[model samples]
Target chain A: MINPHDSVIVRTMSRMLIPLIQLFALYVLFFGQYGPGGGFVGGVMLGTSLILGILVYGRDGVPCRAARKLMHGDGVGLIIFAGVGGICLVMGGQFLNYSSLEIPLADDARRRYLGILMTQIGVAVDIAVTAISIVFSLSPINDTEDTEPSRD
Target chain B: MIFSFEIPLLILLLLTAAGAIIVKDLISAVLILGSYSFVLALVWAWLGAVDVAFVEAVVGAGLATVFFLLTLFNASPKDTEIRRQPVPFIAFLGLPMLGLLLLFAAEDLPEFSDPKSPASVHVSPEYLEQSYQKTDTENVVTSVLMDYRGFDTLIETAVIFTAGIACALLLRRDSK
Candidate 1:
């Protein structure tokens, strides 16, 4: 079989494009406050870019190994999200009430602004990791647990 | 949000939807389905649902196609190649009936962006008017998603996490 990933054009192009895609994902994540994006959209882009990287780089490549470490990363983001909400409840306000966090540096709306940003980040992390994990488990291309006996 | 663009996009969406079923090759069907999502995203953007459009473009058109391709590739070659089978007699009668029923339902839908529409008259108006003051975020979508409805999003993230773990447990084979 002719493997497209082995082609010089495909590999070179993927290497160049992956970083650009990730940069755009970050832009979508942070600037979502002003535009048509949010944590989920940004996270998908981030995860897709990593997937593209793995596709071109192969399983033993540095990027694939790095992605392996990110497998089952569902808990990290959930903790951040719930922890922020828990802090609000602990501060004598309703759960997820951002203004109750009460930083001396900012007022109610500002506090909410910061809170939204924090939660967006948390959601983005959760989504990106979950997406990666899904692709890893669903497809053999990035499988970390199994060395496919049939391929060779 | 051009009205002229919507008709063409919707037409393309329908064609792709039909083409995905009509195509025999699994790979071709998956590719056509990706285009279907792309056209649907265009429809969403044309309808002024920019955020929803962005999501459909990325998740629907992009990752989904990749995922489908991956699954198809992992399957046997015989699985990828469809053996032609006659269309079920019930499908011919049922599909048109379903489509007509959907059309009847769609006809009752409120006009696009109608100020007095149920959605417009509901709490959305307050969300739109007060989101800036509530969250200091310029994008009300983010304000609503990450602030006003933060708990909902929190649960959604947990759901994604659960899905990830489930996939891992089910498919995380150790071929030792």
Candidate 2:
């Protein structure tokens, strides 16, 4: 457990900053088609924001229910990616054949764009959740130490 | 390439690499390594590999440094002094031999941006010409990674997911 009273400045600042960081991550994920950002970069940023929150507020800062949900969501993300590929296969194309999807798009190119967008979102969600899970798994022991009475 | 700027940046990169290895403290060494990654990202950006540079900046410098710091904290009970060890004779001989071999290999490599280079002369031209038309994406890197080589990216994601699972299992075991 973290002493909520400690490091008030950092806590307040992180509270303001985490949302902004998450927004930037989403921008990176969505705008990757036209720029030097992508699922990997955006996902890492999202994870880092959560880690920053953990640093300031401790593990308990992240609600247990939320963490559990996110952990399960990692698998859901992977399934979504695979499901898209399966859809392509069922549509009489090879795996991950994005243009095969019959979206109400103007052309094959638009379908491809939408397919890529969906896949990128899945990848981003998977990576971001995995990153947070790794950080959470690693940090809990340290958190316990902080909460316990110091021997020295 | 801006020769004047590139030269100094290259020098800074070398200095950071050396500092990272030579620094006595583990924490300082990790920080210096992060700096090295940052400078390398800048160099990559300068060379117009913006996507690669972005990955380096975010993953290598940012998340990796944080992970290293966390691992360092958890692994050690206290701030243990990083002892300076004498370089082994094999390392001195082996590293230079490896470097010399690479230098010799470099002789056969085409000059940077040479049109006739194997890289530029191959599928790269086709990819550059057709990526936008085929994928409706302006970013070639994204198209290449996600569309052209989707399986590879999917596998990479699987690997990361496995790593997260492994970390969770290991850490949870320790806690219990």
Candidate 3:
């Protein structure tokens, strides 16, 4: 039932758009301090990019392997956020208290900035993975079922 | 004791909340709820709580509205009020009890963000003082949300994810 000509155009457009959206998300995450954007906004952008990819590829056209990878990535995101806090606790500070991290830089200012940046990166991954999982899981299953009436 | 613009905005917000509660149409009620959330966000911004305003805008205004709309697709429209026995006496007694509790709580609050309150004096000072130098972040709220109180933020994210998962599971169609 798939049209080869339309498929070619949609695939071409998705290939172009996905990279652009990823780059924009990275910009939002890194430049958030001086701007109105940050991890949550960046995560939503990245999530939407993947959602758009799914729309273009029509289920099977997009790799099932990638979808499985994203589900696993969701757990990784949670671990990263929790792992940083666990390290802080192990160092004798309260949970998520990054000030306790002993940096060789010998400057409190440098250490603090490093800690904040580290936590933000963790948060960015957590949000991005969670959002993508939610979107992927909620996709319209009926459409896929209808499109490929099982060969069996 | 009252300014004109502030009173109007407060009135508008209350009106939106009332409309949201009383509307017979579910979609219209959700729309009014969105309006209430937006007005509350504006009030927070006016009170100089920019971080609270941003979150209210994103979660309450955006996500709540989106969820309501998504559920609408599966929901059959119903405006008929479910008939129920009235309990005016209990409602009247409960209203005063709630008001008294609010009054007592207000008496102990920091006089609308007074600088001398323990909360304002202690936390805000350190957050404002060291946020930039420490986090290299202009947004102190971001530093606090993701760093100082990261545990609480993680729980809040989990709560949202949980709600979304629950909704999807409940709504999922079973194969025959």
**DockQ for all models, in order?**
0.70, 0.63, 0.27
Q: What DockQ results for candidate 1?
A: 0.70
The local lDDT score (0 to 100) that residue B140 gets in candidate 2 is 94
Best by TM-score: 1
TM-scores, all candidates, are 0.91, 0.90, 0.70
Error of 3 at B120 (Å): 1.9
- Model 3 docking tier (incorrect/acceptable/medium/high): acceptable
Q: How big is the positional error of residue B150 in model 2, measured in Å on the Cα after superposition?
A: 0.6
Per-residue CA lDDT of model 3 for A1-152, tens digit only, reads 11123577778887898889889878877766655556666666665566556556655556333654765665455566677778778988877777776777647655556666666666666666665555444544554576577677
Q: Residue B83 of model 2: what lDDT? A: 72
Off by over 4 Å in 2: A1-5, A62-65, A141-152, B78-81, B89-94, B174-176
Residue-level lDDT of model 2, residues B87-146, one tens digit each, is 998998899999999999999999987999888887889889998988899999998888
Clashing pairs in 2: none
TM-score of predicted chain B, candidate 3:
0.82
Candidate 2 lDDT over residue span A69-141, tens digit each: 6777766667777888999999888899998887774488887888888888878888888887887676654
Window of ten residues with lowest summed lDDT in model 1 chain B: B167-176
Maximum-lDDT candidate: 1
- Predicted structure with the largest DockQ when compared to the true one: 1
lDDT of 3 by residue, B103-134 (tens): 99988777766778787886889899988887
lDDT (0-100) at residue B84 of candidate 3? Answer: 45
lDDT of 3 at B116: 82
